[model samples]
Target: MSVREATPVTASTEPPPPALRASARSRRRRGGQWWVPWLFLAPALVLFLYFKFIPMGQAIVMSVQDVKPYLGSTWVGTANYGEILSSESFRSATWNTILLAIGQTGGSMALGFGLALLVEGQTRKLSFIRSAAFLPVVVPMAVVAELWRIMYHPTSEGLLNQIIGLVGLGPSGFINHPDTSLGSIMLTGIWRGAPYDMMIFLAGLAGIDRGLYEAATVDGASTRKRILHVTLPGLRPVFAILFVLAAVRGFRSFTEVFLLTNGGPNGSTEVVMTLIYKLGLEQNRLGVGSAGAVLLFLATLVLTICVQLLRRRRSA
Candidate 1:
């Protein structure tokens, strides 16, 4: 054969280079470490199952059973649920709770976001203000309720009324009047909760890129315009988280209502938690109370899920 013909034509397909093959093998080995994430997550999964999921399951089971001290427990199906749903007291309490939640959540979020903006860039002053704001959060809720109760006393001897008197508003019934009792409780809740919201917002604000603000300023954006466009967008995640948290807190609230009003003043300040307390403790209707708790839990779960879905849509 001629020398040129002796060299066979090279095929188009060739084996991968050794380095490429080695890299592929290495990636496969590394990908096997996916179990690392699950391993790390195991503790949290266990805790959630034990504390949250298990208790919820138990509550659901208890909700369906009629429990009596002397009489044996019996399954009553949806009877307890129907009772709460049909009761006039439950309807009024539901309305009161919704109002309280709206007032508390709105007031706290607005006040907190404002405070966060005010202190965002000031390192020295931020520490002092943050500490002062968070101090109320650390105080026991019971103590806060007691303190506010004293301040909300209906008589002129009350601290709040005394202050109003100094301003010539005369003695106003802060908690005595049904018209004002729920509102007064909401004010105290706002006072205690604003600091926590402020801290969350402050953290979010701190993490926001300074370049965005600088770019807006370079474009001659007004402060309000920059806040409307940049700051709010940056805060969307924080806002979602805070909103869910505040809603849950508002729904499950009991200590303050119990201590301050005890669902009194013609049931104007009554809420689901207080209602549950009356059912379980006073009326000794354990099954009914359990049902109420289960309903509340389900409601909270639905709200939280809705908020999360909305946030995901916004982000997308």
Candidate 2:
């Protein structure tokens, strides 16, 4: 009698209807099967296998054989490698490549990082400066190289030499003398490349939390101290990317050097890729060129792997 009939026991255990069913945005639909993404990637994978990997494989095979465009390849089993190792041209090319890589990479990174730091602050008004810095990157490198060739004409009327003359320095041998040719090319490479590197650095800098800076300042850190501790540490990942990319770019540099001097001034600018071009395309020593190319690929691969390992270690 005291139970009051229990309201006919009609209560249900189901969840309540959501108050606003349409309020929660739906997740983008994903493929039902795990293989769906692989399917989507098939085209790119096939293209890479065909274009990049196939060519790379062919190059490797050609490196071990005496090869040419019209001539049949004769397998020589490391003879090509042996010849390259013993050749004076290869030695000179290797040395020049090392110097060029070091110079370009160092110069580009230094200038780019400095510019990035200059522009990445909260001051939104300096966008013009950023644009100016990056303009060279967007311009065709061939055009820049051509412009620099005019500026580096190794005479009094050359634009760079004229500017130097204004500063009381006599005419300089910019691209003519062996002593200055590679250095001159390096200047152009660095100047044109720094802006591109700066863009990457800017992106990395933007990802850094302002709160970290505020906290560091609260702890009485100086500007340089904050940069050393917070900014640079935060940019290690970016630095890895930049380093690998710059190294690769340095290794692959062709157009500027090709147009500027064609590895001239007594082969002072004969970097590996340039030497490869001369051997394969100009001299028709396809096997030797392929060997050089293989070396370039190996060098690039090693650099990339080392960078990845370094990043992992730093992050860990």
Candidate 3:
């Protein structure tokens, strides 16, 4: 036979191996499963778009328009923003807002974390204490403000003043005095918000693996050392989230300030939110109010971004 004819032809074309075929089938299955997550996420995404993103877009548009009372808005690009930034009231309000944010956020987080640490291992009576700590969170802000206002009244009839009088201290107008008004408002905010932070910290503490504590104990680690090395590391994410949330809430505080002091005592308690409310509702200057809102939005955005970046860095 001729050599060419005698040569057997080998099969070059073959079906994919079983593993490759199974992998391809698995990928297709995964593609089908992708819709499940999307389906679950659709409702939340729609709500976010409708409520958050759309309102933000509208606010940005409104910031540039001059909306007169009883007359429709007219486009006056950037004029409202200029006026808002240049106004003395805006400057003072911004300062007060910053002070409130710093005081409330720092004070609440510190007190809450301390309380969480104290109650971390307790089981019986601590549960009742925890509930008591969290009760303020359920109370409405307006009600808390009004309650504090009565307690902070400038007269001898005030609860705080009566207590001070028992100690031979002169009655101090806690909420009416310019020097004390901002601080008093900050204290109220801290009292109202600390419970939430405490709860968050408690949840984070509960999630920590007990094995780490046991291992540290075996290594003769002190309680403070264990906390510094283990507990704090475990709580980093919770702390970051809580701090950002508290900062945002404190910065936007309005109802409490409005109900308690109405930015009184020479505007010592004035905050950005109160200014925005006055500009929009009282003065009928929607454009200026929108500008203040936009500024607050930007500040919050910046803070959120910074927190996210810090979290990523810590995780890495």
Candidate 4:
């Protein structure tokens, strides 16, 4: 091989013209101005401050005070939080919230992912099936709640009870009974949310490299092995995203629980949000409600961080 002498890097010893130097200095100054980035971010920052941070501050402040609607407020210094913490209802609500998050997240992810696998990348004849599966997702939550309420009727005439009768079973108290109320509402939530998760999982599955499956098959892997070794590994990101999003959404769940049980049948379905609504709106204990809200916010924040950390660890 022919060898060539390497060129040495040289520094410019001569100074530029004063005007060019000034121009360069100005450019550097402009580049370093911190406010330039903030200028672009100002709108979003203002909205977030107004809508999210400011409200959060207000809630934190309110949590320590006694807030009576129209009657004015008084500083109580953690009394509201103390009262809630000491209350049986508050404890029950917190426990219920945890159970709900677990049940809802697990049920939706399981059912949705299962359904996605079943119909994954099917032919035209199966294309229409996803649309029908997604029908429950489009229905308004209030309507779904009411519909499920009717279906959950304790009497034999109720849809669910009637279906059970067909299987040679007797009528059972679903949402009408305290012991089963939470589970019944959970089923309703799973039914409503599963289709949405299914769509997301289907999208993830579709994006997976098909050749991985082919390769797995050629390696004499069974169907289950293909899913475990090829499919699931490729979907780690999607799983992480869905897990966090679903858990966060589960934290704020109130509608179906409200419409179905309204934290009733002996307060068995009283999740934190419902309790907050009761405190802030119906019972007019805004301070206590705000405290509960703050606790929920913190819980969600912690849960989110934990999930993200878990995802990072798995990825690493």
Candidate 5:
């Protein structure tokens, strides 16, 4: 047998090819730039920290102390909360807030659902009308309040009064009268808020399966039956979201009440936001105001959590 010559063994001491080195460097550069997204987020973070979080922290601290402005604040340990709870005005404000939230949420959703039904089409005319109807939403709340204030002028010549007069109804005091003040404000809210709700409903309607409607029609289902069985069931998620949003908006209603009534005419229209303003700025009772704010925050948090839990349960 002939013996084969053995090849010499050697380790590969040469560097990795240039392509491998470039790829390694690129990966290192990417790892080092991991903070790029955070850098972009820094401005918003700073603003929220200064304007929102810092103020919230200060308010929480002040809730336990009697804020004396130029003078030193004195710690009172929930005394402010006690005072707020016991106050008659605060009680009234809480009741009014609940009433307004219910009224606005229901009214807006009803009106919006109706409007969505009327304009659920892909025609120029329908689109134009929908846009026109949504004008109230785009108009600033301040302007809406001012415009309604004029319409509700509580005189024979007032816009609403004139229209009612055509039907032989007498001039009615709207926001001007204590008996009707809260209702009038609530109506204003509903009118402005309905358009936003309408937009959401339109989006929801678009998401519904068109085949469902066709199948129902083929089964000789009436329009109302189709809506009840098909449209309403499909829009459950939209309804849930709209309810929360409308409720929160109603509870946070400040600009409209402040500009329109300012919690006046015997405080009939006084809501929690107006009450807080009165306590904090008008009365200079910062501690009490802070406590009220904290309570409001907690209430809102509870409401959101309850809604979420309910939604999850329903889905399950």
Candidate 6:
């Protein structure tokens, strides 16, 4: 038997393959260029810092002090908050805000979901219809407010009143009367907001598993049943997202209400934002207004956090 000679094997010291070398170089380059993105973002960041964050910080500071434009602000501690919290008008505004939020959020979501279902197709007719329906969303809020204001004129000659007259309904003082002011504003909000929600819902619907619908249909499920069991479940995340957006939007509603009713008819449509605006700009109660604004910000934050927590729990 011949004896076999064993050779010692040495570890290869060659550089990594071209692909790996290129990846490593790319990562190193990316790491080195981390500041590049910040450089590009500098202009926007500076604008935000000056216009947004600085004002936000100033607001927070002003919330705790009495702000006088010429005389200068004085430290009032928490008195501003106390005053705002105790004001009867503020309390009423808060209540109205909550009611308006609920009405707008619920109405917009329901209407948007229905519209999404109706227009969920790739056909040209459906596309055209969707675009037409979305016009309200794209129209400036001021324009929408003015448009609705005209339609909501208390006179019988008003566009909306004319339609209601055909249905045997008498001309109602829509925004002029306190009884229907808030509701009239809510309808305006819903009409404008539903299209945005519909677009979001259409995107969500596109992401849904079509096979599930097929299977449900194969199982002889009716349209309502399929919507209840499959569609709703599939769009659960979208619903949560929309609910947060709608709630936040409703809570901060100001422009339309300001333009249309201006919290008129005994302050029936007075929302928190309008109240804050009145306190700060109109009445020059900047301290109290800042306090109110802070409270609103906190409320919105809490609402968002609660919604996020609930969504996480539901997802789990």
TM-score of 5: 0.88
Clashing pairs in 1: none
Model 5 clash tally, residue pairs: 0
Kindly list the per-residue Cα lDDT of model 6 for residues 30-86, writing each as its tens digit.
Answer: 999999999999999999999999998989999999999999889999999999999
TM-score of each: 0.84, 0.86, 0.84, 0.83, 0.88, 0.95
Please state the error at residue 166 of candidate 4 in Å: 1.5
Q: What is each predicted model's overall lDDT from 0 to 1?
A: 0.90, 0.88, 0.93, 0.91, 0.95, 0.96
Which candidate model has the greater lDDT, 1 or 2?
1
Which of candidates 2 and 4 reaches a greater lDDT? 4
Candidate 4 TM-score, true structure as reference: 0.83
Best by TM-score: 6
Candidate numbers, best lDDT first, in rank order: 6, 5, 3, 4, 1, 2
Q: On lDDT, who's better, 1 or 5?
A: 5
Q: What is the lDDT of residue 292 in candidate 2?
A: 89
Across residues 60-179, which tens digit of lDDT does each residue of candidate 5 receive? Answer: 999999999999999999999999999999999999999999999999999999999999999999999999999999999899999999999999999999999999999989998999
Error of 3 at 73 (Å): 2.6
**Candidate 6 overall Cα lDDT vs. reference?**
0.96
Model 6: residues with Cα > 4 Å off, grouped in runs: 1-9
Best of the two (2, 6) by TM-score? 6
Flag regions of model 1 displaced more than 4 Å.
1-52
Per-residue lDDT over 1-316 for candidate 2, one digit per residue giving the tens place of the 0 to 100 score: 4766555677788865675443332222342466778989999999999999999999999999988566576889898888888999989988888888889999999999999988876655788788888899989988998899898888899998999999899999888889999999899989988999999999999999999999999999999999999999999888889988888888888888899999998998988888999888889888888998998889899989988998899789
Worst 10 residues of 4 by lDDT: 118-127
Residue-pair clashes per prediction, in order, are: 0, 0, 0, 0, 0, 0
Worst lDDT 10-window in candidate 5: 256-265
